[model samples]
Target chain A: MPGPKIGRRGALAAGLALPFIRPAIAQTAEPYVMGSLFPMSGPSAEFGEAFTRGAQVALQHIAADNLLRRPVRLQSEDSQALPQPSVVGMNKLISVDRAHWVLVSWTATSKAVAPIGDRAKTIMVNGGAVGPDLAGLSPYFWNVIALAHLEVQVMVPFLVRQRNARRVALIYVDDPLGDGILGQLRGTLPRHGGELVGSFSVPRAAQQFGPVVARVRQTRPDAVYVASFGAQNAQIVKALRDNGVTQTICSYSAFGIDSLRTMPEAEGALFTSQKLDLTGAHALTSRFATDFRARFGQPPLVYHANYYNAAYLFGLLAKQVETAGGTVNGDSLRAAMLATRKFDLVGGEGEFDEQGNMLTQMQVNEIRGQQFVAIG
Target chain B: MTAFLLNLATLAAISGILASTLNFIVGYAGIFSVAHAVFFGLGAYGGAQVALLLVPDPFLACFVAALIAGGLSLCLALPALRVRGEYFVAASLGLQMVAATLFAELKPLTGGIGGLVGIPRPEIFGTVVPVLPLALAALALILFLTARLQRGAFGRTLQSIRDADSAAEALGKNVNAAKTLAVAFACAGAGVAGALYALHLSFINVESFTLDQSIQIMAMVIIGGTGTLWGPLVGAIMLLSLPAVLSFIPFIPPTEVGAVQQIIYGLAMTLLMIFRPAGLVGDQTKGRSTS
Candidate 1:
């Protein structure tokens, strides 16, 4: 009777202890730290903040789900929106903090850091660097943001075939960033049977713009494509209106909308974005927006959606690697992350091509009254 | 290969030429017009504008732009140059700020904030002379001319004004003319450099030519040694190379390194002023009278 009783008690103890063992092993799992180099304090400070918020919300969502096999941490440093600062920030993130993966901010910063990242054997994901010069150039780099030139391919066809645009004028920011966009327009517009009537590049920090306004107005273009950002864009739009050059205008990114938010005169400007509209009919986006708003006290931008997706993708890759009996080496994680397809992450169907660029389509938007409305 | 060397030489030459002219005004003439960048910017815009509006040839544009810059410099000099010492400095700085603001706000004309870009490079006959060869030739010409000017009567008169403006005035020498000419020369050099910069980078934006750039150019003169013909070269090299060197070090973030490098530069300048006030090749007597 005593032998049977002792056997039964031992069996019960073994059953209870089995569930605790895996988590104990999992608890000891090594955390993989993701490093971010962004322009937190410089020219693109607002965009940087939006990116941080996006990445943060995503990471928080993954942690809440206990979807990560190991602890995940994100550390960030300011790049000041220049090449040298980016190189330094990337070094500290990799050498000091031992980050295996890096997400760099902006096209210029990414272009600057590509050589450094290649030398270090670390994977770099570019958030906003959208120049075609970077594409297919480096194997180590992955551009998550759709490049500006690619938009010309998408936008020109749509405008020529769909909107019946013929004569177009381009107003660019007169830098490397604008140069890339200009190259695209030059190549694509002619092929699309649309004529580029005039092109103008402006300098930054210029206090007045009467003469350029006069020149742009002289062209009398049917459509004006503006490639600029921040207060400079605001000033240009204001100058365009003040100088009486009123034509249908389109901008590349949320810059025009961001400009309109501050400048009442720029209320009807149109732009494009990668983030799903919170006000859209998509159930997932609506649900995410509700949750995000409740947590952060505002609607989420596309940058936040990207961050959530990156975090989710990172965790999923880590889990897959752990299951495959492979260690979370930089190369291994990068390969696994790249191989991801039809991944129903937080931002919708996630995909990455051979160039490490995200394949998600962008949405067109126009600012009406005080809000951004989906155009298509 | 020759083309590359020429372009490199041209950039150094232009910087040197600009530096030499600035040396006369700041080092020898003892007028630290912080608005020197504005003059430089004016030359760039003027050069590009003249080339775009009047002449298609970059070389001819260079001349027209220089004349425009020189003419503008005189206009700026009349009211601003009358003040002595700190007041002059304040007035010049104000001009720089106002000019930069005008360039941005007056968008209809200046392309507000997006600087003039794609201004054609200097061409010989039908051949588009490569930047390197053109720059090298330009550098040689600027250097030769600067060397000649330094040994000329104008140079001596400019030095006299720098040594003692009152004395120079008492000697019946036109002090204002000397100062204005020195400014015009500096403005011309800056214009040439700006035109080349527009061509070389194949881009020009307002961000590249800021009040901060004016400050940097001034630092080049001060750090390299005031009034010395070679001062700007050494200073430009130091300022440019220091950041380049700091960029190579790992473990330190570039931004942090940049901040630290600036701090060290400030300390170095302070020490330079304290111990070797004459700078690397500065004459103590000249320093007292001029600097």
Candidate 2:
């Protein structure tokens, strides 16, 4: 944490040796290598695996189709979803691994890794970190997921229209992920003629939710919305029922699906998802879902959709750019990323805004029996 | 080669400070302070705030932030000191969770999950120092602190407290006061490191300082050697920098490579504990300094 100290003697000695050690470095013509870092062994390992699987698929597709014209390879690093490991992982990715592009996941790791990416001048793409302010921080960084700040704007309208909710209660983890969503809800909910009646805040990865559930039950709102992760959300749902709060509880994406597999109380929870229901045979959805199932040997989770789309988009962009006779260096690749006007993928057409937020529609679903059924 | 050295040096610098801080709590004071990340987070937030809000004199803000962090650590220590061992570890972990959540949710102050961005690097005495120099400066601070702590009577007293708090307390030493001071100093040092980390990366969030970080800090101290200065430096360089270096092997995919590295690290730690309980630079035995 302290700035690197320069001892008087050591500084002088280093100052003297600097002239001798100095040599203007020239750029080498090595093929571009990208590093994708994620939490592959810890709690976040599920998402990390999915992201890597997507990246791997994308890289394969690129190679199969000759997307970049000049063979580009990808190296994935596991930060174990922790800052120190991520920092360590990224250092290897850049200095040792020699990667040009670095992709990371989730808000926590992204926040830790972004600075490292910027310091190293590595082109960093965030597949999972969706905090709104992330885009404005560093030029080299961009996120594939929608910002948490936009959740209210994106979800409030849906909540008002689809769920027919008059009053809403908010239960969120007390961190940046929760804060961004809360900010969005505060800003957009009132505009949509809905009121956030009461709110509860819990710590991240909280195992016990009895007190938090008690706080939410006291609110007695018509609908309760929890912006939490899988395990925490599952615990909260159980607590909510135990407290006799019969309100329709909804959670933010993937929590419901991941929870039902672990916590049975998550049977009928409603949640928002960026991925559409591909259960039934539809052209784009069916192909992706079927392929994903074959590859991973299970139905694609919510985030898998984004990964699939991101990979496809990457291959598509690389091909188009290479076809245009542009090198897939940082500037050219960034231009290609920017040039993506409308990417018609599996679920919908994605139009990346100037901020690189892929403006696309999401689906709302409720767990009916054993599957996520599309609601309206 | 220079880049590799710089990377290794940077990891060592961070690890040294972290290990030193951990040593004060777990090594010297015999406390399982899990909330080490809180001080680290505070430093990061404080440093970033100082860099952004009180521009033109960010270094001044670093001290201010450290003071605030130290004060907060004292507040946390007052209640946490009541607990012992694993329970104490759990409590500290709870504190870390609570702090991180607050940092994320308290959007007005901490910038939420999107985190604070564009934190300006320090401009000490009107010179724009690059990251590597700043890294070297951090390493120097660690070295200085390590050496200073070794020579001082306060250091010996602290170690005595860790060695046997009951005996130390019986000898007319204020055990609680010593423990609290150790925690505070460790937190302050971690805070300073956090500030430097902010400057180096120019971005931060609550996610950066989680319970996992507390564990990592513990690992740095454990793997390096609790009381020695160079232990953390060695561990950090080896563990943190090794993965980065391995990422360059073209045949290994970065993701696969990362997993392999973790497996290797986990095995290394296990072997070190089983065969050499003293750790790389630790005292002769584990749990000897503290009971």
lDDT of 1 by residue, A61-176 (tens): 66777876766767666676654346556655666556667877665567556655665677777666565556764677776666777666677776677668778888887555
As a whole number from 0 to 100, the lDDT of residue A75 in candidate 2 is 62
Task: Give the alpha carbon lDDT tens digit for every residue of B1-291 in model 2.
Answer: 456566566656765676677776776667877778788788888878887887724466557657877878875678545766778877777788788778767777777765776677778787766555655665677578757875797777777876776788788888787777777877887887777777766667676677777787788777777777777666666566545544433454444655665676678678777766777777775644463
Q: Write the per-residue lDDT of candidate 1 for residues B1-291, one digit (tens) a residue.
A: 232234334445555655655675787667787877666666667666765566546676567657766778775567545786888877877887788777666655565543454455556576666555554555567656666776898777777877788898899988887878777777776776666554443334454456777787887787678867676777765655444333333344323443454465568667766766666566655454453
Q: Which runs in model 1 stand beyond 4 Å of their true positions? A: A1-31, A187-193, A204-207, A254-257, A279-287, A310-312, A345-347, B1-291
Question: Each model's TM-score?
Answer: 0.59, 0.81
Q: Number of the top candidate by lDDT? A: 2
User: Model 2, stretches more than 4 Å misplaced?
Assistant: A1-32, A115-123, A148-163, A183-194, A256-263, A275-286, B1-5, B24-35, B56-62, B65-109, B112-114, B125-127, B145-149, B152-187, B242-261, B283-291
lDDT of 2 by residue, A1-376 (tens): 8998889899868645543331222134355566777777666666677777766655655676665656655666777666656766676667765676777776656767676676666667776666555665466676666666654566677778877875888888776567667777777778988888888887666778778777776776878888776356677788888778788887666453444644556666777766576765546567677767777687766666676666566667667767898765556666887876677666666777775567677666777766777684
